[model samples]
Target chain A: MRINRRRYLTQKVAKILIWMAALSTMGVMALIVLQVLSEGIPVLSPRFFLESPRSMGREGGIFSTIIGTIALTVVAIVVATPLGVGTAIFLGEYTREGRISRVIRFGIGCLAGVPSIIFGLFGFVFFVIYLNMGWSILSGGLALAAMILPTIICTAEEALKAIPYSFREVSYSLGGTKWETVTRAILPNAMPGIFTGIILGVCRSIEETAVVILTAGSSLIIPTSLFSPVRTMSVHFYILAREGISMEMAYGTGAALILLVLFVNIVANWRLNRYIRKRA
Target chain B: MSAIPSSPLKAEVKKLNFYYNLVQALNDVNLPIAEKRITALIGPSGCGKTTYLRCFNRMHDLYPGNRYEGEIILYPDQLNIISPKVDPIEVRMRISMVFQKPNPFPKTVFENVAYGLRVRGEARRNLLEEKVEKALKQAALWEEVKDRIHDLAFNLSGGQQQRLCIARALATNPEILLFDEPTSALDPTATSKIEELIMQLKKEVTIIIVTHNMQQAARVSDYTAFMYLGEIIEFDKTDKVFTHPSIRLTEEYITGRFG
Candidate 1:
């Protein structure tokens, strides 16, 4: 086939435009990361992480914030992983193409697409007021778990679906029951996919501010129990910015949050890549 | 080649039918598989060869709504193999299948062959080791893989993986072994090796193989059953089926006139 001069020129221009669009997106992300680190690194001191929250210009640490973030995230993962994975298993294995599965899938898709602000509002009204677990880690963690559940379920379902049927057949050919095949070959083979979802869930939970603000409360001290007041790193960053704290301190906390997010992405992407390679 | 026992046990299927939803995969299939004979089911794609082969071990029953009607008597008086009250697991223990594509679990080579035995609660370490070695040797892979038994099964070549699967099946001590196009995914050299192994294996256990490869069927099988659409067109000694077939469809399929 021969290319016309006009068509060739148009194609060349289109390709250049596409490349420019891709490169510009990457460039923006790089600039933001660099800007945050450069401006915030100067304010990052050991005392910033060790001391308790206090008034403007005074030394304070994020120990309570860090502990609360960890506590809430752990609880969220504990609640979400099983429910999400079990739902995925049912969708992928037990449920054939049917109306109920389709409806459930639609519900999950909608949940995933729902904005973070909406989840926060729901948590604030339902868990905080209706359920009367106001500003509690339990409420915050449950809300975060609900927020990330769809993501976990969908990713896990895809992973399970990717496993070859022959693996199940081999297990069954060895006289293993359906449950045995799932727990043994199916789950093990799909572990990397499940792990990827978990990593994404953890990353989202750690960065979530709106949901934590409403359900977890902004108390500076560490929470004594699940029902006690709590504050996470993201909420802390927001409070630091709005409470007339130094811009340097707010930027520093922002940079730390960015690093944690970056670290989670790197680890999750590496694991996902390794899993794909092993399967290949 | 091992002389068919003076009075060998027979595997019988009586007016069996298989349906996948509205479509019939197998229709009114009736045959007796002589003990220790290599019976090859030769047909084109979607002709129910694999479907019929899966019935020997009740492998198809696991998939929902893939129903089988009628009796598949492994030794007679065993009741219908597809009966809901009967556990397919027990049926599988006596009849194992090797798939078209070699599928080795993501485990060490030694563990691959020892899986079936271990699942049966045969826990004696020495016995397990002996069985693994014996099964691998029987599959013609022991000498090559003995030193690297700890290596991951995925690291092996496709042919080695297929042989490993064969070894795994052998470890189960099944009365019958089913192969659904065992060499269809292998290269010519690998295909020949598997053919040779099948020829050897038939001496120890009854085998029902489904293959599109007429040459392989000619080379490995003792009895050949030619199927078309959803019916068995012809079943006879391999030589008769290939050289002097009873039905025109069987002759045409074997002679490459048409599928």
Candidate 2:
């Protein structure tokens, strides 16, 4: 295994290229975080959080948008988590070799690849227009749930795959049935990955605006029911930025959106680290 | 040792043929496992010794595309165990297995041993504690692990993990115990310890062990069955099998001429 001069030179080049690619991206993320923090800090106050959405010059807040985003995310989590985890279990445990499983997997891949605006168009026609839901929170949540289902399913499947087969064998040998083994052993072992999947799904859903904008109308008042019109943080930011609002409000809202995304990533990373520690 | 029946031929197999897909893993294998004694199945890799041992309790049924045709008769009762309706779980409960590699459940030492009892609905705190302690003592692991009964089983050395597996098997009070190359993954010291444990355990449970180590078979087993090409070449008392095998293949395998 002696290294020649040519090989050594190539190795050095490869190392530099790898670091360059990694550091460049890391630097961009850090710069974005710093920019958001420096700009958004002055705009955020305890009172701002409590107030409702309103036009500037007249005075306004993001209360309705915040509540709507929370509601949409909660519904999405409930809908996606079970379906995603169950699909993961089926792929990991029951699927050995089959055309159907392959088809299902390819379908998920294509679903994830579909553009958000296209999804918005479909939701706008299917749920909001044809179903006559009339810009409702339920319609928005279901649309977002559809958008993020692929994320949850893929991550959860990987987590289930990461678990050792020996654990399953041990459980079976001890007379644990398939369902018992899945719930007690497989799911517990894959919890970190599953949690990561969920958080990522939530983050992606929250960051999306096109789909929410079409399904959940730009109502400034707080949504009292699922059928009522609502607005999310992303949609609010979009409306504010596009409608020629004061530059300060637009920049501040953008920064707030960035912070929200960062918060979700942090929680997901913590869960992932905890899972890795357990595995180790 | 005193608890085991003195009778010989506790379990018997007849005309057993095991196939993995179209490839035959075992062919018309018949043998008797005596009570209160160790029977070692010795051969090279792919010789079907492990496969044959797995058939005693139908562990082979775990895999798809595997088919077995034969009668396995349990002595005294003369039970025909090859029927598809026979529950593999019940068979496993009565005849426990120690895998080739040490596989302790990812749990505390106490939980690992008590797993078998708990599966059968034995949840009394006092009884569960006593069984865990007794099984550990039987496997000669009590002295090393008694203080850390609550410690994770994965933290132990390979030998300790193997013993813990043995202890887990013993907790079920199986009438027969199967070992599939139990010491192949262990060091010399651990191998010797497991060998000693096997010798001690044979006094109560019928033992059927698979081994690549000829010396281990000679040292611990009462009888040895030599297999090659998925067929038994010779089977007799351990001394006779080593000293004067009936088949040339058996002699060559025993003499380390080929695997």
Candidate 3:
């Protein structure tokens, strides 16, 4: 009876600890959301969103910043999606488990761990100095693309791996060539997972600040072309907050970024789930 | 027991042995698969009947760590299907396979049947539609799925999925079809439906089925080969194999003495 009581007490204690842990994690995120809302909600207005900033961002809006963010993300996706997905397919399908595949996998793993600032420095040197691109959207996009490539490749490979081997067997048994099998059976089924990776890359590129600041020259002027200097919302926010330009606008930018990510994640996750269900 | 009519040769497997690296999976296997007939390969689990069936299409070549010896000679030219000179893809085109579990490509029902046709250079839309319809009808699934042809293959029930896989195999009109325990994962009604389909299908394509169910072997097959420990113990008409097995081991297995 005593032992049973002791066991029950231990179980209750463990349950309480689990609840506390979950609540604490939620509490921290809630605190961040609340903080951002408190600091930024009053600053949100049509003018704040639609008008260009003036007097070194002490007034006006982030219209140019929004355009810059969109352009940079588009360029990043254009650069990264094909390259990352191709590498993933090659790793997952085209090659056998050997020294070369192992080395490539190890390199990707290391790349994933590398600091984003290092990518910033590399972009600054390779694009700004060597190539003389000089702080353009193209330079920033390329650096961000490099930053997200490892993650996309890793996720895409895992998604490809998740497909049942039986799919390939069925394709081959029906006389599908390796290429036919990939396109018809393996790749089609792997689409949702691949999309998830691409979406993740987009989110990463959208939020990245250091790479944007270093490679994409900070300009208050709206970018006219890929070669022109641009500034992302994240870089704008960082400058506004750290340089004491405008805390109100900075917090507003933070709120917008958070909402954008949340909206994207919810929509993408729903679509992905639906697609998987339809296939399954 | 029903008498099996005499049929011409379809495939001739001679002294074929298979290895997965150092371990031998098949040993000196010799069997003749007759044309337009259902030949059932019956044995306990791990008896290598599925392994032998896969050899007909050279499905063994897909993965590494697998090795083959001797020859599987198909009809007409009696070409050794296992030779490196003969493309494995071409071999699979002539000889198709259906696995134990139903594996329908995650596409529309129409597309699933059309996949085999598409792979072999059938690109004309009207022709593809007609062939897909014919194959689905041949699989005995058309009546049930005809209305929703564009629905995803995954929407079908398990039995329907298995039949769709059969239709996928039949789409290219292969000379031979290898079924690796095709109905093992199905219910009794679905199993009977597939068995009936197999019997009906023998009027065209030659059938080689690997089965663990003795009753299934008895019902659908014209010829039954009992395998044990990687070697075929008896190969004879289904009636003879079941009613009067020559080998004690086969008799023992059929009589429920041991697997």
**Top-TM-score candidate index:** 3
For candidate 3, write residues B87-144 as lDDT tens digits. 9999999999999998888789999999999888899999999999999999999999
Candidate ordering by TM-score (highest first): 3, 1, 2
Query: What TM-score fits each model?
Result: 0.92, 0.90, 0.96
Write candidate 1's Cα lDDT for B1-259 as tens digits. Answer: 1223233555877888988977898999887788888889998888889889888878877667788888888774555677767799988888888999999998789877887887777789899999999999999999889898988899899999999999999987888899989998899999999999999998888999999999989999888888878788788888878888878788888888887
**What TM-score did chain B of candidate 3 earn?**
0.97
Model 3 lDDT per residue over A1-280, tens place: 9999999999999999999999999999999998998888788888888999898788998889988998999999999999999999999899999999999999998989999999999999999899999999999999999999998898899999999999988899989999999988898888988898999999999999989999997898998888999988999999999999888889998888887788889999999888877766
Candidate 3, clashing residue pairs? none
True-structure Cα RMSD, model 3: 2.2
Mark the regions of model 2 whose C-alpha exceeds 4 Å error after superposition.
A1-5, A56-58, A125-134, A271-280, B1-6, B75-80, B121-124
Arrange candidates, best DockQ first: 3, 1, 2
| Better-scoring candidate (DockQ), 2 or 3 | 3
Q: Write the per-residue lDDT of candidate 1 for residues A201-259, one digit (tens) a residue.
A: 99999999988898888887778999988888888888777886767777777787887
TM-score for the A-chain in each candidate structure? 0.90, 0.90, 0.95
Q: At residue B223, give the lDDT of candidate 1.
A: 85
Candidate 3 residue A170 Cα shift, in angstroms, is: 0.6
Worst 10 residues of 3 chain A by lDDT: A271-280
- Cα lDDT computed for each candidate against the true fold: 0.86, 0.83, 0.91
Global Cα lDDT for candidate 2? 0.83
Clashing pairs in 1: A51-A61
